[model samples]
Target: MSKLKVQWADQHEFHALLRRSEVEDKPVLLDLHSPECSGCVNHDRNIYSDPDIARDVMEYTFPVRVVTTDPDRASTDIINNHIYIWSPTIQLLAPDQTRHHEWNGAPRRTRLSVGYQTVFHDTPGHLTPDAFKAQFLVARGKAALRNKKYGKAIGLFDEAITRHPDDRVTVEEVSRWRKVAQDGGVIESTWDHQHQVTTSPLAAAVERFAQTVATLPDNVLMQDWIGKPGTGDWQWYSDCLREVVLQAYQELCNFAVTAERERARHGPRFNDTHRLLGQHRFAYREFQSLFIGVPDALLDQTPLRSERSIRENLAHMVMAEWWAYRPQILHALDRGRKGLPPQVVPATDTVAQHGEPPGSHESLHELLALYERLHLRNTQDFSGITDNELGIRSAWWELGPVELRFRLERYIWHPRDHAVSIDKILDASGHRHTANHRFAARLFSGLETAEAALIGTDGFLAGRVDSLMTTINERADEAARLLSQVTDIKPGIG
Candidate 1:
C-alpha cells in the first residue's frame, strides 16, 4: 500500500482542475489548510497518508490542496464562497464547482507525548480514515445524483451503507439520498411520482423563475457591480437586469408550453428525456406560428447580406438534424446498448455537403412539411432513451463535444433559432404581432419593471424582495394561463 501523494495548486490551476473534472466526469476534492495550523499538518501526515484512504480518494475524486494563508498558493474565492473560519477544511465539489459537502477542523484523534508516556487526544473535527471514506462516498453519490446518474448514485450509496454501517451520520444521509435516486430523482412533488406539481399560481411562477435563474451562465451571474446605484459601475447591474428580464420572458414562454403539455392527451412521463422531447413538439408549434401571414416570396429573399434566405435556413435546419444530429444520437444509443461508457465521437460535417442554397422551386409549405417529418422520425429514434444514456457525448461542430441531452435541446432550439431570424425578416417587411404576442409583451414589460426595481435595490431588503417576487409570480401565472389559451390559434397568410 502506498501513501497518498499531495498535489498542491494555486487559484489559476484550481480553475483548470475544475475543467478537467468536467471532462473526466469526476468531482473535485478540495483540501484547504494553513501553514501555522498543527491539525492541518497532522492531516497531511496522518489521515491522508493512510493507504486505504488515499486509494479511495484517488478513485473517487480529483484531489487538490490549497494553503489558505498563502495568496500565491490559495484560492481566496473558495475560502470566501464557503466562509470558512477553521484551519483545515475539506470540501467535495461537483464538476460545475458547486459545493456538495464540506467539513472543517482536523481529525478527532491526535498523538500526544506526556513525559515518558504517549497518549492520544480528541480534536475538534472528526477525520478518522473510516469516517473520511464514508464522507467521500456520500459526497460522490450526491454529485452523481445531481448529474442524473441515478443507477451509479444508488450503487455508491449502497456501498457506503455496507462499508460504513457504524458511521451513523453518513449512513443516515446515504439512506435519504438513496430513496431520492430510487424514486427516479424527482423529489419536488408528492402528488405525482414522476411530475412536479406546483400547488399554486405563485408556486408555478416562482418555480419557473428559479429554473430560469439556474440556466444563467456564471459570467452573467458573477459580474462585479461595485459602487452605489446610478454610479459608473451601476451599468453592470443594469446590463444584468436586462439579461434577466429577457431570460424570464423566454422561460415564461417555456412555462406556458409546459402547462399545455400537462393538459395534452399524451403528456410527458416524469423523466428529463421525455420532457425534452415533448418540449421539442411545443417548440415546433411555436416555430410554425412565426410563419403566419408571411408570403412565400419573402422566404426566398435574404433578410441581410451574407445571410441565408428563410427557405435556405429552414432546409439547413432539417438536413442538419437528419445528417448530423440524428446520426450522433443513433451512435450514442448503440453504444448505450453495448453497455459502454459514453465517449466523444467525431463530428459529422453536414454543412460541407449541404451548403448550397435551396432552389426557388421549393415552396415554404414543402419545407415546413419536411421539417415536421424529420421531427417525427427523430422522436421515434429517441423513443426508449434513458436518462443515463443521455449522458453519452458526441462531437458538435460549434460546441466541440456535447451530451445527448444538449443535442435534444439543439433539436428543439435550432428551428427556434432560425425562426428568430425569420421573425426579424418579417418585422423588416412590416409584419404585425398577433394578439397573443402583444399580450405576452405587455406582461413582460410589467414583470421587467418589478425585476429592475428588485435589481436596483440590491436585495438589501429581503422582505421587500420577497414581496416583489410574489408579485412577479402572480403575473407569470397569468401570462401562462393566457398564453396556453391562444396556443391553437392559426392565422392564414393573406
Candidate 2:
C-alpha cells in the first residue's frame, strides 16, 4: 500500500485551516498523535499507510495532524472536552468547529499503588483499517445530522453499521446516533444543573454593568476620559471612572460572547502577553503572504505617493517593534517590579536613526528571518511580564506618558498598520499572486486604546471575570447547601 498523500497541518496552521474548512463546507479530520505511543505508531502503519482509506479521508475532510509533544498546543481544548490527553485520539469536527464524533484509540496509563503493589490497565486497541473507515462514516453522519440532513445522516449511519458490523464499538455509537437522527437529531445536554447555576452569575454581573452604564451622565460619556490624570478639569476622577467602567463592561460582554470560540482557537490560558504575541504572529503571517511571490525588484521600488517601499515598510516595522516598542514596555515592567518611579526619556527615532538595517534589502527570506529573530527575542523577554505591571506608566514619544498596557496594544497594531501599507504597495505594483488566498484580517480598529485603558485599571478583567463569577456562584451554593444540612431544633426538642 502507498503512504497517505494528504496535506498535514500542525497547531500553527490550524486556525487558517479552520477558516478554509468553514468556507469550503468540509469537516475537519483531526488526528491527535504522539510519536512515543505504540497505538499511534500502529495507526500510522496500518491505517494511514493504506492508499484507499487515505483517498477516502482526503475526499471528505480537511485532515490535520496535531502532535502531542508540545504541551502548549496539546493541552488546548480543540473541541468541547476533547483535549489531547491521550495519543491516537481522532476527532471529526463540523464546519462550525464543533465536535461531531471522537474516538480514543488507547487509554492513558497511570501507575496505581494498592497495598505496596502497582497495577496498570489498558483500554481498547487501535482500530483496524476497515473499522477506522467506518468511524469516518459515522463522523460524516454526525456532521450531516448537525446540518439537519436527517435522511442523509440516517443512511450514512446505516452504511457504517452494515459495512463494518464486526466493529462493535463503532456500531454501538452509530446505532445510538442513528436513532437520534431518526428522531429529528436533537443532541442531548452534557452539562448538569450545577453547571447552569454556576454560570448564571456572570450573566447577572454583565446585566448589572449594563444598568450602571445607563445611569451615567450623558456628558460624562461624551468626555475624553482617556487623557492623563491631573491634566483634566474638576470631577475628572469621577468622569474617567465612568468611562473606564463602561469600557470594561463592554469589553467583558464582548469577551463573554466570543470566549468559547477564542479558547477553541488559541487555548484557554491566554494572557495579555499571549494575546499580543498572537496578534503579532497573525500580522507577520499576513505580511508573509503579501510578500510571498513579489519580485525582488519591487522590494526597493517605492510605490506612487508613498514615501517608503514594501521592503522599507517591513524593515521599519521589525526595527521599531524590537528597538522602540519592546524596550519601552520591558523597561516599564522592570521599573514597576523594582518599585522605582516612572522614568521620563526621549523616544528613539527608529525610522531616521535606524534607516533600513542590514539584510533588509537582501532577499525576502533573509528579511523575514531577521524579523523572526527579533520577534523571538521579544517573546522571550516579555514572557514573564504579568498583568499587574501593565499599569506602570512610561513617557513615550509624542504620545506623552502612557501605561505599559497602551504600549502593548500599540505593538499589536503597529505591524498591522505597516502590513496594510505594504499591501497597498503590492496593489499599486500589480503583484496579486497570493491575493485570492487572503482571508479577512482581524482588526482592533480604535478599540485598542480603550481596551488598554481597561487593562491598566484592572489588569485585563475580561480573562478572569467568567471564572471569578463561577467561583463566587459555587461558593454561594456550597454555603446554601451547608446551611440546609444544619438541623434547626426547638428549645426543648431535638
Candidate 3:
C-alpha cells in the first residue's frame, strides 16, 4: 500500500476498519478516543468534505471511525500496529508500515465529546489560509437573513467576527447588514421600467405607522405623545409604518373583495362613476364653476378625438346624471309605496351596469346601427315635444316635506367625491401627476359641443324638458355622435 497522511476523529468506524486492516496485513491507523479531545467537530463535516485531505490518506491508513462503545473491534488491530493510544485521537502509520505516531488534543484543550449528546458537531479550530471555518459562519449568517431571522443572522455574523478578528471584511459585512435588520430591506428596481409596486419594506413601514395612528387605549405612549389633540400630531409619521405588512394587506384585500361583490349588484356609477356623471348633468349650467374645467389636470388630451366630440360625450354624461337619480326622485314621489323594487332592476332605472363594456352589442355593426337609430329618433322627438311638456315634473317628492329631487341631488355629491379619486388614479398611472387635477376635462369638452346641438334644435332647455326616457334617448344619440368621432383614440385619459 502507498503511504498516506492521516487525521482522524470518532471511535466507532475506527474500531471496525482497523480490525479488518490488521487481518489483511495492511497498515492501519486506528483513531482512539481518550476521555479528552476538543476539536473533532471541525474535522468531520469540514475536513473530510475537502478533496486534498481525502486523497493523501486513501491507501496507507485504513482510517476507521470510532466512538467509545466499540473499541474491541478495532482494539486488536490498534495494539498490533504499535499504534499509540489517546482518547478522541488521530494517529498516522509510519511508512515502514508497522509503526504509528499520534496527535493528542492540543494543550489545555478538552475532549470534544465530553458533555455533548447532541449531534456530533466539530467545533471549529483556527483554520489556516483558506478561511474555511469563518467562511462557513458567513454562509450560515446569510441563510439566516433570508429566513427573516435577523437575530440569528446577527449572532452568526458576530461569531464570524470572533474567528477572523483582523479581517476587515467582517466589519464591513456586519455594518451593512445591521442597517437591513433595523430598516428592513426589500428588492425594488424597475423591471426595465413599466409597472410600479408599493407594498414591500417602504410600504410596510408606512402601514406600521398607520396602525399607530389608528390607536386605542393600549397605545399609552403614542397617546401621551399626541396629548389632547385627537392624536393629530402623531399622524404625520405614525400613519406609515407596518409591523406586519402582509397581515394588514390581507385584511384590506378581504374588505375590498366583500365590498366589490355588494357593489356589483348596485349597478355601475357606484362612486366615482356616479360623481363624474353628476358633473356631466351640471355641465349645461350657465354657472361654469359648478362643473366645466373641473377635470383640467390629470387629463391626457393625446387621444384621437377632437374638441367637439369630447363636449358631446360630456353632454351625454349630464343626461346620465339626471337618469341616475331618477329612481330615488321617483321613489320620494311614491314613498316605497310599491311593494318593493324588482330584484333585477333594468338599466333604465339603474345608475349603472356591471356587465359588458359600454357600447357593446352582439356585433359592432349592431351597436353602430343602434346609435344611428337613436340619432335620427332623438332630434325628431325633441322637435315635436311642446313647451308644456318641458314645464312638467315627474313624481319625486311628497307634500309632507322635502322633495325627492333636491334630496337626491344632495347625495349626488357622493359621486363627485369618487370623481376626484378616479382622477388621481388616472393622473398617477399616466405619469402626469402635475396637471390641474381635473378628471372631467375631456367629458366637459364633449358635453359642451353636444349640448349646443341638442338644446339648439327647435326647443331650448326652458322649452325642452321631457320624460326621463326621452331625455336618455336624446343623450344616447349625443353619446353616439361623440363616440363616432372618437377615432379609436381616447384623449385626456388616465
Candidate 4:
C-alpha cells in the first residue's frame, strides 16, 4: 500500500498562519467549510482530492481546515447560522481573519452585466500549485489594501487582472470591492448586500405590482371594493394574486422564521422565493390590464359593502391568515389562563361559508373593524411566541414536530395568492380573468418552483420580517389612498 500523504494545518498553527498573513502582508488559503455541505462535499471530491491539486496547493499558501461543527450541543449556533445561509463560502483573509476577496454566489455574468461594478461570484476550480499561487497572490493583494499597501497589493491584483485579461471580471468590480474592504478594514463582498436586498424575494414582486397598479381609480373592476362580492377565477386569473404576492411572501418568511427561530433564517436563500415573486408578477399583470383604459362599465364598481369588492376580500384575507395561526396563538394564550378561546373561528355568514360574495352589504368602517380584530389576533399570537417553541420540537402536530411558522405563513400567503385573482375579476368581468388563466398558471408554476428552491435550503426567514412588514404597511396605505381619490368621482352605478 502506498503510504498516505496528507498535508494538514493544526488548529493553532492554522490560526497563526492566518494571523501572520495579516501582519506580514502575506496571502493565505483559508477554506471555511463544513463536512456535511453537499456543495462542499462536491468541491472536496472533485477538486481537493485531485493529486495534482494537492501537490500544487502547497506552492500557493498554507492550507488550513477550520471544522465548523458543534458536537457539544448537537444543534446550530451563530457561526453555523452563517454557514447555513452561505455554504461553502471561500474567503481570502489577511492571516488575521480579515476577509479580503470572497466569492459570492452571484451569477457572474448577470452581476457584471449590471451598470454598477459588482463583486461577481467565482466558482474557482481547484487548480495546480502554480495556478493556485497566481490566484492567491491576486486575492491576497486585494486583502492587503487595508494597511495602505496599495501598490504592493496592486501588483498581485494586477497580475490576476492580466491572467484573465479578456475575462468579464471588470476593474470597476475589483476596485469597488477593494474599497469596501478598505473602508471596513475587512471586505464583505457587495454580493452580501445584493443577497440581503433580494432576501425577501417578494419585494421584487411588490415593486413590480406597485408599478403596475400605481394609477388605478377606486377598483380595477371600476367598482367600489366595499360593496361587491369578491369573486373571479383567481386561480385562472393573473399569475400573482395581489394580496398574497407580498402577503404570501411575508407568510413564507414568517414560516421559515417561526419554524427555525431557534436557528437563523436567511432571507429565502434559494430560488423558491424568487419563483414566488414571479407568480406575484402575474397578479400585477392582471391588475394592470383592468385599468389600462378604465372601461366605462367597470367604473361603477364601488367599494361599498359589496360581496366582490377588493376591500372585503383583502379584509377577509387578513382574517383567513389570522385563523390559520389561531390554534397556536390560543395555545400560547391558554398557557397562562385556566380557560382559553376556541382554536377554530370559522365565519358563519352564508356568503363566507361559500366564499365571500360579489356585492356590497357593509360600510367600510364596519369591514375595517373586523379587519382590525384579525390584525390584533395575528400580532398577539406572534408576540407571545416562545424560545421553547423555537428551539425544541413542536407539539403542534403528531405526524412529526412540523414547523408551525411555515404553516402559519401559508395562511398569510394563501389569501394574497387568491387576492390577485379577485382583484382581476373586480376590474374586469369573466372575460379578462378567463383570457389570462393560462398565463397565470404558467406564472404560478414558476412561483411554486421558486418557493421550493428558496425554502428547501438551510436558509432562514425571521431575518426578513422588518422589511416585509414595512412593505405591507406601505401597500395598505396605497390601497387606502386609491379609494380616497375615487370618492370624488360620481358613482358610476352600472
Candidate 5:
C-alpha cells in the first residue's frame, strides 16, 4: 500500500472545482468537517485515511475538503443553507450542486428531492481496504440513482455487485437500489436530522421564563415571607409587581371562573379545585396581616371566611389583588421613600367582613368592577415609588421580619401555584390546558426575571434562573409539540 498525496480545496478553489466539475459532467465529493468535532476526527483517522479510499478519491472524483469552522463565509453559508448537514458529512454532488448523496455514521440515502430512490445498505465497521472500495462503489451508485441517471446508476450497481459478489447483503442492496431507481415514483430513504432540534425564538423565550418561575416559591405563606426575606436592589421587583402581578392574578381569576363553569357542568370533580382556591384566599389574608394593622392604607384586608363559591372566590381574589397586596406594597414604598418604618395597618373588622356574597352574575360583575376601581386607586397611589424602597421590612410577624422583595416573591408564587391548580382542574375536566400552563409559566418567568434583576449577582434569585429557564424550555417545547399536532395526525415521521 502506497501513500497518496491528497489535495484539499480551499473555499475559492472548491467553488472553482465545482464549476469545472459541472462543465465536465463530473461528481464532486465534499468532506464537510468541524475542527472541534470528535466524530470528524475519527472519520479522518478511520475512514478517509484508508489507502484504497484515498486512491479512489484521487482517481474518480473531484474531492473538496470544507472545514466548516473556517472563517470563510461561503463555506459556512453552504453548510447552513444547503446541506443542513452535521459535522463529518461526506456528500457527493452532481455538477449542478444538486445534492446526490451524503453519508455519516453508516450512512443511508435519505430524501433530498422527488424522483430519486435507493435501498438501505448495511456497512459494517472494521472493513478491509478492498471492502471500503466496494462500499464506495455502492455509495456512488446510490448517488447516481439520486441524480436520476438511471442507466449510469444501474451500471454502477452492476459493477458494485460484481465487486462484492460474495456478500449477499451488498449484492441484494445493489439490486434493490437499481430496482427502485427503475420504478421511481417518489423519492424514498430512511434518514433524519434527529441530532438537531433547532430551538425557535418562541421556544427560547418560553424556556427563559420557565426557568425564572422555577426559582420562585410555588406558594409562600405569611410566615415564610416574614421568616427569610432576602435583600437586594428592590426596583425591578417594584416595577414587575406593579405591572405583571396584577395581570397574573387577573388571569388566574379568569381561569378560576372557567373552572367553576366546568364544575357546574360535571358536578363534583372540581370540588377539590374550588376548595384549594378558597384555602389560597384564606392563606393570603393571613399573609396580609403581616404588613398591615389598623389606621394605614386599606390595601391589606383579610377575608372573614374562605371562599365558598366561584363568585365568592372571584370576589375575594379581586379584593386581595387590589385592597390587600397592592396596598401593602404601596404602603411599603411610601414609608421607605419618607424614611419611615414599614407601617402596620389593619382594616376595620367591618371592612374585613364586607366581602360580597357569591352565586350570581350580578355579584361577579360587581366584584370585577370593584377590582377595577381598586386597581385604578392603587396604581395612582403607588405611581411615585422607586426601586430605592425595596429593602424596607415589615413589622415582625409570626415568622420574623420580611422585606418587600420577599413579599413580592410570595405574592407572585402564591397565586401562581393556585393558578396551576386551576389548570390541573381544567385538564381533568378534559379541556386544553396548554394555555393555562403557558400563561402561568410566562407570568412566573416575568416575575422571576424582574426579581433577579433587582437582586443582582449574589441574590438567590440569580442562582435559580438557569434551572428555571431549563424548565421553561422543556415546557415550551412540550407546548409547541402539542400545538403542532393535527386533528387526525399520523403517529410517525412526516
Candidate 6:
C-alpha cells in the first residue's frame, strides 16, 4: 500500500553492508553488474522494482549494487573472484560472508565461473519485463534446487510458470526442474540458451585456399613429365592444374554464399563491426558489442576498412591486369598443344596503371561470375602451359617486370594475403587475443594444413606452411600490443 523504496549500496560499502546485515539480522542480496550490461538494466526495472520481487528485497535483505568495472569498488581480490566483469550476477550472502544455498562448497556458480559470458552476454537492449520476472524466479528456483530445498524449488518453478506461460524456454526449464526434484537426480543447468555457432564460410574458404596454394610443386621440373612439346600428350598436366584452380575457385564461391547469408541475418549493411574497438555506436547498432577494446580510430585511418571493399578492389585489379594478357597466353599454350607454331603471342593490352576503385559485394559477384565463365570453358581454349612459360616477361603494372610465374602466383596469393590482412584487422578490433579467438584461429589454421595435404604428394611447401602459422600467431600478438597502447581507460554508459 505504500510507495516502495529500494536502497542500493555500492560495493565499496560492502563491508558496512555486511555489518548492517548482522545488526538488522538480514541477508544481503548483492547485484554484481557491469555499467554497460543490458541484463543489469533489466534488473533495475523488472527484478529490483517489481511489486512482488521488490517486497522480498525490501523485507528480507539489504540490496547492494556493485559495479564491478568501477575502479573504486572495494576489495579488488574478492571482486575479481566473485564478480563477472562483463555481466550481471546476483549472489545472496549470509552476514558471516558464506553464500546462502551454496551447494558442494562450490566456490563459484558454475554458470558464472565457467560460462558467464556465454550465458548472460548480450548487446545492450531492453527485454520484456515479464521475461525478466520469469528469469528471476527461475534463478531463485535453481538456487533452491541446488540447496536441496525441493519443496521451495518446486514452488518457485510453479510461480515462474504462472508468471511467464508464453515463454516456452522458461516453461520447459521449469518442467525439467520439477521432474528433477521428484526423481532425485542431479539438476543440470546452463545459462546459455542460444545455439552454438560453428565454422564460418569465409574462414573455411581462406584456410582451404591457403592449403591449395601450399601444395603447389615449387622448383620442380614439369617439362620433363610433359615430354617434347610436339611428341607427348600433356593432358595429365593440364587436367591436374585445372583441378587445383577449380578447388580454389569453388572455395571462393562458398565464401560468397556464406557472406550473403550473414548479410541477411545482420541486415544488408551495418557499421557495428567498427564499434567493437571503440566506446560509442553500440547503443543499438547490430553486432556492436560482440567484442570489446578494438581500436576503431586506427582502422578508419588505414587501408583495413571494410573487408568487402578490399576483396572487391583486388578482384577488379587482378582481373583488369590479367584479362588482357590471358588471351595471348591461352592461345600460345593452345597452339603448342595442337602441334602448331609455338610462336610468341604478344599481350595486346598494357598492364593497368593503377588499381580500380574500392569494390562491393556486387563487384565481387561479377568477378566470381567471370571466373565461372573462364573455368567452364573447354580445355581446348587453354592448355600446354609448361614451367618454361614461367619466363615470359610481364609487369604487375605497378611493380617492375615480374615473371609470368609471379603473375599467376599473384592471382592465388593476392586474395590469400588479403584474407590474412582481414584476419589481422579483426584480431586488432577486439577479443582477438582471447582464448576463444586463439582457439578459432588455430582450428582454422589446422584445417588449412589438412586441406593443403590433399593438394598433392609434393606436400605443403615448408615456407608456405611457416607463413600460415606465423600469420595466425603474429596477428594475435599485434592486436594485444596495440590494445596495450590504449590509455585513459573508460567504460561505456549503462
In terms of lDDT, which candidate is strongest? 1
Weakest ten-residue segment in model 5 by summed lDDT = 291-300
Highest TM-score model number: 1
Question: Candidate 1's C-alpha lDDT?
Answer: 0.54
**Which lDDT tens digits does candidate 6 get at residues 25-62?**
66677766565655566667565677776776667668
Instruction: List ranges where model 3 is wrong by over 4 Å.
Output: 1-279, 282-324, 330-402, 407-415, 433-494
lDDT of 4 by residue, 1-494 (tens): 75222265644565578666656555555555455544455556655666655655555456665544322221122123223112224445454343444433211110112221122222222233343334444565655555567666666666666765543333433454344444543332211101111123453343223322332332343333332122243233223234323343444344444544433453423233233333433332333223222222232233322123343354444434443245443453454243332232222222123332221223333333344455434443454344333322223323344343444445346645655646665645533433222222333333333333333333344345454445444543454454356554332211
TM value for model 6:
0.32
lDDT (0-100) at residue 202 of candidate 3?
23
**Candidate 6: stretches off by over 4 Å:** 12-28, 33-47, 60-62, 73-79, 82-85, 89-122, 187-494
Better of 3 and 5 by lDDT: 5
Q: Give the TM-score of each candidate.
A: 0.35, 0.34, 0.20, 0.31, 0.33, 0.32
**Candidate achieving higher lDDT, 2 or 3:** 2
Q: Each model's C-alpha lDDT?
A: 0.54, 0.53, 0.34, 0.39, 0.43, 0.41
| Distance from true location, Cα of 297 in model 1, Å | 50
Q: Please give, for residues 212-330, the per-residue lDDT of candidate 1 as tens digits.
A: 23222233333432212222443344333233344445444444444444435344333667667766655654565455334554654544543445665676576567755676677
Ranking by lDDT: 1, 2, 5, 6, 4, 3
Off by over 4 Å in 1: 1-4, 84-88, 104-123, 188-494
Q: Summarize candidate 3's per-residue lDDT along 364-429 as a digit string, tens digits.
A: 222223322433333233333233222223332222233333343443454354344434444444
Query: Which residue runs does candidate 5 get wrong by more than 4 Å?
Result: 82-88, 106-135, 146-148, 161-176, 183-494
Question: RMSD per prediction, one decimal?
Answer: 27.0, 22.3, 32.5, 22.8, 27.2, 24.0
